[model samples]
Target: MGRSDVRPSRSSPLAWGVLGLWLLVVVLALPLAGQLGESTEDEGVDYLPASAESTEVARLTELLPGGDTTDLLLVAQRPGGLTAEDRALVERRLERIDALFDVAAGDPAAAGVVSGDGGTALHPFSLGELGEEEQGQAVGEIRELIADPPQGLTLALGGPGALGVDAEAVFESIDVTLMLATAGIVAVLLVLTYRSPLLWLLPLFAVGVAAVAAMALVNGLVSWFDLTVTTMSSSIMTVLIFGAGTDYALLLVARYREELRRLPGAGEAMAAALRGCGPALLASSGTVSLGLLCLTFADLNSSSGLGPVGAVGVLCALAVMVTLLPALLVLLGRRVFWPLVPRHGESRATGRDTFFARLGSSISRRPVTVLVGGTLLLGALALGTFRLPGPLAEQDNFTETPASVRAMELVADAFPERSGQPIAVLADADHAQEVREAALATDGVAEAEAGREGGGWREIQVFATDPPESEGEQATVDALRERLAELPEAKALVGGPTAQTMDLADTASHDQRLVIPLVLTVVLLVLAVLLRALVAPLLLLAAVVASWGAAMGLGGLVFGPVLGFEGLDAQVPLLSFVFCVALGVDYGIFLMHRMREEALNGADTRTAALDALRTTGGVIASAGVVLAATFCVLAGMPMVVMAEMGFVVAVGVLLDTFLVRTYLVTSASWLLGRRVWWPGPLGRRPAAPGQRAAVDAVPAGAGPRGDAG
Candidate 1:
């Protein structure tokens, strides 16, 4: 199709109108964006499946007299046995600790338990119905209350409450930290990629607007749809906005530059650019959004919530980039390109002279060799999955060993026969005694006793003989659950910190089984519809899946050996798969779409593959680096899950960008020739000198076309 068919008028007023509209959106969204943090919750319950046993216990607890309690452990330990003086010091500290809880809504405090070894004492405290902030402050006061432990005696706070405090401390400033870090990374990468001081600012500014808008939308989702947003989801959303928005900006700007060399004015150039790349952008965002939406099928609350949260970020980025970015670029004119500006009628280097073009030529000469080598490399990397450790334990969740974790370690070592973490049994009040009796009879049970009775339920505090989160403890919990299951009248539900972790891991596995196939299907259908061919979409999907495997393999090697992570989080594999497959397919779409466009426009299979790579290669590289770097920011987070997630997605994106899209996909397409477009017109028709496909010359990819400046 002719350029005139798709181009808007050079002097259109839409650019100014679009700019004005986006400014209004920013003004309206800023306040709501601030409230987003207010809606974010990071409790264990928040991550649990709504229908899980642990979730029901958590829910039932909140309905009791004191709502939810902040349970903490005060540990006093020494290498040598406690002397009379040390015992008296522990007694005095216990009094002070009791006073701390006594002031908080007058909740009753339990007596301290001295280990048989006489070297350690564990005192459990509860602050009833405290808000998150109040809980943190209360934990702090307790720490201060026992700050002066006698020289050899080590005093530390452990238990769920202390752990929450440490975790919350890491997440408290997550949003601001993530935004600043992501923006800084994108800015640096953008400057390096574009090599123009002025050019970097436009995309950066546009992406910032997108992030603000996305946060506001997310906050609204929280209020309206009751969407769950955790620090992990929100942080990932922020990274997605900056990374994806910048990527879109890069692609559009590259296309606009190419158009500028041929078109008469900025408006027409941008209109033509948008017209060319618009479908691919829409298709790319659609694939990502739909793929994320597949997470809604997950049973885990955090995983399900992340689907919509991330989709919101991607959609907002797309809207701003397609509208606000274009308006800004058109309004600024060719001057934004500065120094490397494309002047009308200027002749420049063609694809034949470009690095990607040369690389494509070499691959085309020996397509099978490149394809086999690339596949073998990807397969080898995938073998690293065998090296991946088991589910991440609670103590291993943090990148650094917080005080709580250290305390837990001491308590575990001191009281080797007893579990510090309680296994809560929520049983029918009518049959509470029977459930308690059964729990005590379980194989791993060290102790089981009836506790709080309210809201038609009775709490049974059960302690396993094994340490918390140990394989043996998990087995005991399973045995107790089975015993309770037989007592139909009891309707007992086992929950607590350990139970929650088990449920999360189980649910994560279930989610993987359910969501993975759905995501692949959604992505496959999108590719099929977009490309209008079965074989091409299948090939793209295979390449994407292989890339994901390679990325996960790299994580297996890096996470434990290089980063000292204890083990992979239960959720990482599924989340990473969704991200790598969904987001990684983006580069594939840009390449394959452009290649099909070239094919329909009279280029043979070889020329189409080479030109597509040559045109899209530079911008895809820039976008990939920017995105990878943006996610790499998560590595600095104190949370192991976030760091692992960041590493996998970033690696997957880099692999997809530099290797899969550039070589494997290109070589495969070249070898397949027109057969890649099987069941489509291109599959049947031989290359004719003057014939163009019925479809318009749909432009995609983010690199300069040959010999046009």
Candidate 2:
């Protein structure tokens, strides 16, 4: 009546129930995932900071006689000059487009905003009162019809409508590609780490459950709370769930394998493993989720929305990994490890496992040297920060030049004095003429003209003397804003493609100043409570921050000269910093938590630090590889900003896993000894000499929670 080693037991019911629940979650999420794309807003107004003047203008314009304005540019270029045939083709096509949709409202005269040069000309075709899906489709159809132009003419589309379609297309591909790449990376890494085909499948399935649950929960949050959910947030959340969920699984499964060496029953072994690592996993997830929530303070809707969505992902990963993963592993029993199986009462595997042990011993011999050397190296890498470029231009956004960017470039080349994108001034209709004159007189104004009047507001189109997003145009936009601000009676506000970019840059700078300190404080508090020590938390925070700076500095070097990038995205530093610290600290927690257990069990400082490294290093390395690979998937994306963010985060994680946690933190702890646990009872105790005490931390029949994971 003793428990059988291969017993069917109660695990059958638990396994089936867990699997069924997860399957149900996936089924529920499928429809929600399909609807998630609808939640994304990529319009120029969508990115504006709520308090920005442009946002007010956008809102007022939305409520005008037209619901919202969508601008599309139709450009036709001939290398030499447009012939009579090309001009005829252009006129016919422009009319055809206006006729295709009531969008332009039968206003052919309004569609004649063109470059002075006969070789390149772009018309301003405006539409209003359309849904986003409708707007994108309209752009797609225009692009299709504009093709097969006169043989010598080059046609391309840009402006609000075309840009939205291009952005949406990029994000659509990002979602499917990132998920498949992440899943493949995890599956391969898990197989390599476990060396057991069956063992890798359980965690993969468990993480899949976590991803589906996260999507469903996030959709629910968006629906119930009216929180914003962008296409960007949804895709990023998927990577987080897969990467973080697999990390939790690795920690739990590794501990379970170690426990199986002494415990006869799979249930007992798994339970013991969870008890050992559960608190650390919970606390680490807390740090990430709460740190993400700190982003709610951001003024930009897209950045703030990522806060709740990302937090939901990490929490869902924790739930599935802790519950479903353990159940499946127990159901599969010790055979999960296959030919490399651990058996009860067998000799432990010290026969050839000396990689991390040797590393620890080497550091133990010269702790000061390793600590000093690591700091200097990271500091040198940090120097690359000075090399980083400024705010990335919209033309540089795409990996391969899209037709939209190409059109903008061609317009720039052919029309040296005219801007490809114009500033749209919304002013009171009473002084619409005065506003047009004021815009025309502005210092950098190339030309200005009054357009439409509705809902007490009129549109004044102003062109800059320089190309869009160039310094001269930025000056002109500023002049327009300042001059327009003087007309209180007019209630003027300026916005357009260039203004949106400027506002995004300003908002990013503002959010970084606000969110960085808040995230640091939040993470520090979590570390303090989890580690239950003052000094250690401070030390850990310092190390993670150092790691992030080094990562960024390295990014600067590669991003500019090495990778041939012109500039970093305005949001790259803020986004990279948050992820590096929040996620990188997981490895630190794994290492230090194990060290804490050893110290609590009375191993001397040196022995405990070395023992912790020896036991936990492999799992930490594996987790780092999986996380790094997942983030690097963003590099393959068409957007340069995403590529930079991914590269920075991936590098930072590797630094955290191998250099900082493995060498620097380990060495620091070795030097600090029991003092590393300052104010803790363990910190006050004297050591009972060296190597022998490590062997006796958990004696005879004590539970596996005493030492593993």
Candidate 3:
């Protein structure tokens, strides 16, 4: 099967035309990224549930006096404790920060900057009605002023202002750092898988095109619609485009390579390749997209926004991989396969009867043992959830300790036992005096002061005896809210850092309860419809859910003890579940779709499972590695939440790839035999005319896709 069987590709200039048009589109849309950067929202309101109490408080506060208040903490500390000189240094820096901020915000000093216990200072800068850029510049200037303090006195910024600014800085870095990291990873994996220098670049180039297109599309949506773009969602979208796009590319390229062996011409081979695998790729992408869109019902706006953004990424990646990628391969002809290029009728290395072949045979030998053992292992790992970290605090958000976190630490030490942070209370101006008195009289209140009053509302700053986001402080807030509720005329709202954190944490919990079941239901329904077998879909979802639980259990053991996380980010479990289940179902589809194809073509159930594993082992494993590595790239990020999410997804993908898809699902398919495909005609029908028996008794764990790369 050499050149004798290889026919020349047709002179189809249309492929080149497609490439040219997409390139032109990319050129026109690339400039929108700059505008998108300015639009990357990381504000408190951006993350909260639309109708949550905290969201209302944030809104009401904006309506008061100047649009919004920029709370900033100026920390000054000395190792031995604060000295007179330290206090004076803090005062001077606060004055400088205030002046710079006032200039940027076009407002005079309103809330005075005062030191706490003479060790550090609280310079809560409340500004109104500034553009996002102006606010960023003001925060930047403030950060710079505190950049270097007087000798022996260290100054660091904290509060909502500092957190928002820092978050935006990380998001801005994604353009360069996260993208480069993802590309580097994909390149290495592709090189190892394809073993060709030039071959790897084609799929990578397609991913880049998809990424740009998706970003521009997202920017347009954000610019014109309710689609919100935050640092978290934007990052997740980038990962989806590269990771999932590459997954689709792997499947298409694998099929195209197979077609190249049998078909005469490259153009004809690509057409056949798309004909064979196009539905599976589109189905997988659709499954992921639908699962993500189900998040729209989520009460958490930030999480819900990711639904559409992620769906956009998958759809865009699908468009490029299916169209642009196939066009490129057709244009390049056999050269895309490089040194290992497939000649006609050579069967393209087949890579069957490898480690996975052996694994499938092993499962066939003792199906029940493998199934029970795998389930027990996963269940045991689930026990680690007992050791999982507690609720994440703002100070613990960073992978590396930032100055703000350090500043909070200093305040905690110097003002030991004082409400490490302030509690903000908003009440009607008519009942303002009463609210202030009530707050001061509260048992946890260390001090209370009246804040800016406007728009028929007044704010009161209540410094509690407990630290920020701590349970004790939570109790104080609850009490304050309850007391305020008694005065209906006050229309008091409890907000600020602590309140926002409480709301976010509670929302995450609620979203978990609501979104998880919906996500599972969505994925399962898609699988059932696609496979036409209720039992098979249930098995696939069960494996995915098990994988998620195992991944999180592993995360519980690793995050706090190994990664040094104090607690799992409230959002990690939900995000991880969404990713693991949605994408995990992908592997199941890859296997079952092929098995069903084989079964429908008249192969027996056992032969079909082995053949599916035999043929798909390489592509599935390669796809898994690409997706896992792309996610693992997030582990290097400075944010603890992103790191945890990355770890869990990486672990889950690998587990689903090597263990569940390869072993558990395959064994289940064999044990259930025809019953695995229950209610489907494929389950009841006999072999088709050309279908053959299982490949000659391959040893266990020897499928071609078993490289574990």
Predicted structure with the largest TM-score when compared to the true one: 1
- Regions of candidate 1 where Cα sits further than 4 Å from its true position: 1-12, 100-111, 689-709
Q: Candidate 1 versus the native: TM-score?
A: 0.94
Better of 1 and 3 by TM-score: 1
Error of 3 at 611 (Å): 0.6
The list of candidate 3 runs beyond 4 A from truth reads: 1-8, 67-69, 79-81, 87-152, 348-353, 441-443, 686-709
User: Candidate 1 lDDT (Cα, whole model)?
Assistant: 0.85
Q: What lDDT tens digits, residue by residue, belong to model 1 across residues 1-709?
A: 2344234335448988999999999999999999988899998788888779889988887676655678777788887777777767767776776665643332223336778877887777667678888889888988897798888988899878789899899888677888888888888888988888798999999998998899999999999999999999999998899988898999999898889888778888787998889989999999999999999999999999999999999999999999998898887776677667777777656737678777876776566788999999999999998888777888999888999999999988988898987898999999999998899888999999888889789988899999988889999889988999999888899888778888888898889989999998999899988888888999999998999999899988888889999888888999999989988999999998899888877887666887888899998988888888988998678899999999999999999999899999987887677878887877777767464322112134321222111
Report the C-alpha lDDT of model 3 over 393-420, residue by residue, as the tens digit.
Answer: 8778888876667767866766656766
Clashing pairs in 2: none
RMSD of each: 5.2, 4.8, 4.2
Lowest lDDT 10-mer window, candidate 3?
A: 700-709
Each model's lDDT comes to: 0.85, 0.80, 0.80
The TM-score between candidate 3 and the true structure equals 0.92
Q: Which ten residues in a row have the lowest lDDT in candidate 1?
A: 700-709
Residue range 247-342, candidate 2, lDDT tens digits: 999999989888877787788888899889998999889989998898899988778888999999999999999888888887778767775777
Error of 3 at 206 (Å): 1.0
